[model samples]
Target: MSKIKQFFVRNKKKILIGLGVFLGLLLVAFAIFFLNRERLLQYAVKKVVQKVENRYPADLQIGKAQFKGLATVLVTDISFVPENQPKLLQIDTVEATVSVRSLFLGRLVFKQFDVANGDVTAFKQDSVDNFSFLYKKKATGEEEKTKDAKEKSNYGTILNRLIETAFENVPDGVNFRNLGVIFQNNGRTISMRLPTLTVEDGQIQGRMAITTDSITNTMYVNGVIDPDEYLLAAKMYAEKAGGIQVPYIQQKFGATMRFDTLSLSITDKVFKNDQLTITGESSAHGLVLNHPKIADEDVFVKNGALKYVITLGNHYYSLDTLSEVRVNKAVFYPQLTYETRPNRKIGVKIDSPNIPANDLFESMPPGLFDTFQGMRANGSFKYHMDFYVDMAKVDSLTFNSDLDGQNLEITQFGEQDLRKINREFEHTVYENGKPTRTFLVGPSNPNFTPYNQISNYLKNAILTAEDPRFFTHKGFHEGAFRHSLITNIKEGSFVRGGSTVAMQLVKNVYLTRKKTITRKVEEALIVWLIENLNLSTKQRMYEVYLNIIEWGPNIYGVKEGAQFYFSKRPSELTLEESMFMASIVPKPKQYRTYFNQYGELRAYPRYFFNLISGNMLKRGLISPSEHASVSSYVNLNGRAGNFIMAKPDTTQIMDTLQLAPIDLLDF
Candidate 1:
């Protein structure tokens, strides 16, 4: 103790000097912080906002920045532009509290961020929409460019691609208060009532009510993102607010669909252009969807429970084939696929467990099969549909199916049945799927003919030309479906029907002619119903189809077609005439122009007729005698039909001169 006292007495002045030096350094630090505080706050906030606003094509700014508490900053006059929008969004003020210790290390570590009272207006123009751009970049171009390059080299699973889009630089927490969003597009506006939206950790949850087109619904959604952190903050909010109250809205298929309750489990890398798998359950109630091209009597899902897993790929931007889906209590697997170059295939497969016929019917919107729903149905059935495509050529578009059970029942009729077959089914205004038109082809036209009255040659020719596998297939064929699928994908349009007799019958009888998705879906449903219900015998269905199908200008039935073209009864038509019938079936009106100035059929018609004859013979559809009789000459002036004579052997005949048949499956 004595030695310590002596040392202290000797160094009192030196100790005082050291203390003054330390105080001077502290004062300088305080002075620098006070002088540059605004600049630091602005730098930190602007950096973060810019990162968050990268997806928005607008300007964002803050004004009147000032210090609040020791580590809190208050920024006023926050605005996001362009300012001329009818629903401009203006945030009156924002407060950010950061970690003071982090500031000392030159890092901006946010503790809490809050945005209060934001008012936003959104509207659409005739040619453009304000929110349209929001999703325009849904696929990030830069990220995509890099990803494409990587795909070329790696071309792995979609999950690999998803990994390329990594999510980083996420915020600790963000809060919004009194936010309002109104959207107007195409003279229709939807308003969203979202009192608050908060994003923290790895979850994006909200509850909101949205109204548009005089319909409203409340949506509640809770989703887990970035499963890697699912455990960290899983219970963080339990101690504070049990749950957040959020309001939001979603637009799908150009329509507003409501979700009463939605629980989602999705990976966090979605925004990063990486692989995304979303598993969710939804409860929907009485929601009538609206689309610009949708019918006024738009279909609605009243109430239902659904659970689904959706997966997306990076290269083809297509859905994966392995996914589970449930509606009500029924379970099904739906797969949509897009392949790369050389293969270039697009396909869809729906596999469902056997289900009750009425239950299945009731689950789907009745209007989808308004005409077919009247058919009596009983029993349970399961089916698999394979829409095969080869996007390399124009010929291979096939929609094939296999039905496991016969659960439908149909009533029979006499010749009067032919009259009922003539009813005009719903038809499309065009192939665009908007605005439907009723094609009145029947209600029992006088030209209708019974199955027995129709010529067997015409039947064989139509079967061989349209669908050789029609009798064996339920709705579509296997080889043809695969081939046709490819062709459709290549053309990027439904130019080719790639349909079987059953599908064609449903289309001509119960749906519009438009090539839109709606028509196709309706056509599929009706075909399924008819086939499963056995609404009519195949023979009767064919009779009805021939009677209702469009033949030419003002010509609706085969009877009218037979009298108009050959001036004879269907039964009296010869084999050559039958081939002509089949050839012109696709373009009956165009066939009328094939006659020369002399008023006789042209060489082009004879050529196609002969081609189909050879095809029929090769397929063993026609006997040798029938082939000979039909191939005798052309009908230009009572000549038989056209043929390329050579060795009689089937194999030898095909080896010479590439006869190149008319290709009925050709567009």
Candidate 2:
């Protein structure tokens, strides 16, 4: 015990020195951290920017930035320049205050954001280059929300957020204090003010107080709208224009409508008098109407004359007339029409006993078609003042004249003919070398289809072509791989592949269409991963495949392909047609050159159809009767000159088919 105490005393000096050195090092570390705080923050910001750019790409550029440790807020000045546009759409120069408390919560608790005092400038371009700041994409569940810096867009994702945010409830759950909007066009400007508004799920609910008076027209608007329904209604509103020839009216109109402070309520109202109690909104930029549920029968049909009120700017226009009114009510009565003469002239006539001819003509303003400037209107009335339209102003005249009541009874006037005006149809071919002109359907095609059918067809096709035993085999096709390598070596070039359908689906959906073995190999791996993923739905897979598949030369989708070749819907394809379609699954363009004068299919490419169908039958994929039907119909020809543009009943035909699966090894 005495020796131990003596040793401790001797080492006391050394122990004190060691403690002093440790304290000195700790102080030095603190000094460094405090001195380089700004540089550290700058570095952090740069790293954040890099990460954001990697995740969410956009044409984003940041200028000056300021961070206050005390307030825990970051102020950044930003400029947004959309891709392909040299002009800047927005510039925020003021302080963008963010809550430090929210940041801490975002880091460890919940994700919430607040923006204060962000000075921004928004630009509206010509018809070709308008700026849109909304993100209208489907939200997936796997998104990460805890990142310090997230990628964003000014026109795309940002706009989408703003739209979604507009419907987001106020944090404190308070009704809006004010909502105001000013719409400007040419020399005319209209303003709408709503002091009180409430935001809820996809709806802005408030009374809009409006007042407007022009030289020739005046309107007052006092109504409530449900913004979500209004959005749907706006889409339907433009569609209601049906055959009207207007230049991007749907896109241009929404920019003028501002609903941040106003709540829109959409409702369906039964009729009372000549008014409709419409509750829903049309779309972003559209006129407000009463809820449909409260629609008045009298407004639709009243003593042979339609009477209704329209709110524009701030005043309401009470209109009662029998003809020549551009409003939709005038056309809903069914037989009403405005015909433009062929001589670049204008005239008005009505065929209603209750509606006096003088009142009808007087109700319509002269040179109404003049607003459509470049388009000219010419022609004289027929025996009963029924005018013949000149080609120049035909589109404008159609717009000003509602198609609802007027059928515009020009016998043999097919609605499909209008597709030619915009070159909506393209020349293409189907199996059996049949040539045809097909319509280009946008996302709004009328075909009713579930997503699965298209996905399965694509999956099966790829599997059959690449690896027949995809379902039963593991990720790799060993036999197919060896065969492919040997065959390539023997041929002295890449001649075949052994990728499965799952792989092809992955390639088509996510990767580029490069014809290389490297890409194919990567695609195969991706396919295995995707198939194993629980996210892939049968319908979703088929829908994507159906859209991406090349059904013919410049033709895509079963809907368009079926319609193009046979002038029939997808459901109407016969057994022979199905076999023909399946036969051409390997190559689309090889048999796309056999069409009649009217762009109708005149023959089928028999070689591929016969070869594939025969093989499928021999492998027991199809029964004897199914094989017989397909063989008999493969090369049959229709009567010459009997082809016409007509819709055929599809339901009965698709139901009549008794198809069989092809053997896996036949291909």
Candidate 3:
């Protein structure tokens, strides 16, 4: 040990000198790197431009790029132009400071970013667009073959990564001046200009001016963000006194939406146990919406808010039951889940627990519930709904909904009185938003038929064809509604409506014929009021329904319809004649389609007759003898027969009728 120490001491000087030389060389190399940092940055920029140009159908150019400070980069005259297309992106100058530690880890984390002047414009003419290439994928043959074999996506992981990446890209400080984004398609253009936008110390302030064709609007935005905690709160409002009008929707979709103050916030985002949960809140005040299909006038809401908790798992996404939705003073809880594995399924549940009747009435949107505007009510109502559907087994779908009122009563009426149907009143028929005819719906009218005067066969047939359980149920037939929902889902379109006799009666008596959600909802409210309050007896309501519903073109009520088709009074109509009248209720204007040029019933109508007759027989509404007495053909001897006879005989009668078996539950 002593000899080794002596030898080490003798070489210590030489070792120290060698170590100093190595350190000096390392310092010299770092100095050289620092000196050529600008060149290195430019080369890196060139490489990135080459890569982008090679991968996309675009050319990226940067006139100059250099290092301004230790971790700051300055770029000027950057442009990205697609081949044979307009320039997609252009920037006059940009300066960004990146995290030096992140740079060593091969990641560019911006600490501060500034843009002096820039513009991004997407243009489309015919079938080509300049910006679509950003989302276009250049998949190889191998990738295409392996795509189906790829493992199922982990929604939790994906969402977590998305949130992380988004927050990572948010710089601590940002300053943008004179930035514009424009989108032009065909002849329409939508442009937004940001004169100035700044974010400092987690606070954001910005001003945006939007132009759609000839209309322009300005908005002010203010927000606060916490990057490390994934928290954000933002609000947007108009520069003027009213709400901010959303641009382009009115021109493109024929819809208008405006909001006085829109606020959004993300309170928390947590990832644990292979799941991601996010909580947020959104609120709007003085919201206005308008569309031809939604309503004739603008729908206005005073205040609305939603507090939501969303969760993402491996094969499912869910909105937790903790979510609460509030409109004015009314509040409800909603839960929704969608699964992608083990047979795709969707489930939804909503619960509103006994809110005040007055609050509920006041919560209704203005234009939508005009009939309930000034309505005063007492007591409270609770609602619950649970719906689930498996795409693979839609036939086994489950749907249940209930609205229970606790001694609910109306003290005052709105624009339209609810109790008018109890007495004789003038009923008007509207076609295409115009009143075509008006008639008295009582014994005073010559053609008006009393409930008892109408043949039982006619009433039974109409009930069977329209709503089999109308007399037994309050206002809604759950089975028929379920059938309608199933059919609509299978068809992927709205081809059926589950309207009961009472609903139809309410619609005919108190609502317009125009098909709108507002009108349908109003019809439902009226039906509920009438049924629950016993304002009109079941027989009286059915009587009014038969007296007001259209059965054929220019034909109204059972008396007119029976005479128009069979030249007989309602009480004198035969079973076959009643079935014929029932069949034409859905499409009164196209009744001729059910008959041939010879005025004989078509094969489908014959099957419909048998179906209705069979249902009536099962319900004991008609005896076996009466069911067997139904004729296989309909004889139209009134004005309708003349129209059918005028058509040329081009349809060939089928020898063997083949139709899908109708669901017994549908009736």
Q: Assess every candidate by TM-score.
A: 0.61, 0.27, 0.79
Local distance difference test values of all predictions, in order: 0.58, 0.37, 0.82
Question: Model 1, 1-667: lDDT tens per residue?
Answer: 6998988899999999999999999999888987887677767666657754785666677777778977787879977674334335677887878775665554567667787877677778796655434323334688887755554433334343334333333456667776677877777778877666676665555555567656554555444445343221211111122122222233435544433233333322332344455444444444444443443245555455444455544445444455656554456777887766555777788888888766665566543334434433467668787775565644646676776765444343211222244344333333344543334444444565777888988888887777766666566555554554454455565434457788887766556564555566666666665564555567777877787665555566788777766777888777887777776676655654555554444566556667677777887878888777765342432211121122222222221112211124422
In angstroms, the error of model 3 at 611 is 2.3
Per-residue lDDT of 615-642 in model 2, one digit per residue for the tens? 5566455567865765423222322113
Estimate candidate 2's alpha-carbon lDDT, on a 0 to 1 scale. Answer: 0.37
lDDT of 3 at 149: 30
Candidate 1 RMSD computed on C-alpha atoms after optimal superposition onto the true structure = 11.1
lDDT of 1 at 595: 51
Q: Candidate 3's residue-wise lDDT over 91-177, tens digit each?
A: 999999865545444444578889989999998888888975664444568876454233125667666767886776688899999
Ranking by TM-score: 3, 1, 2
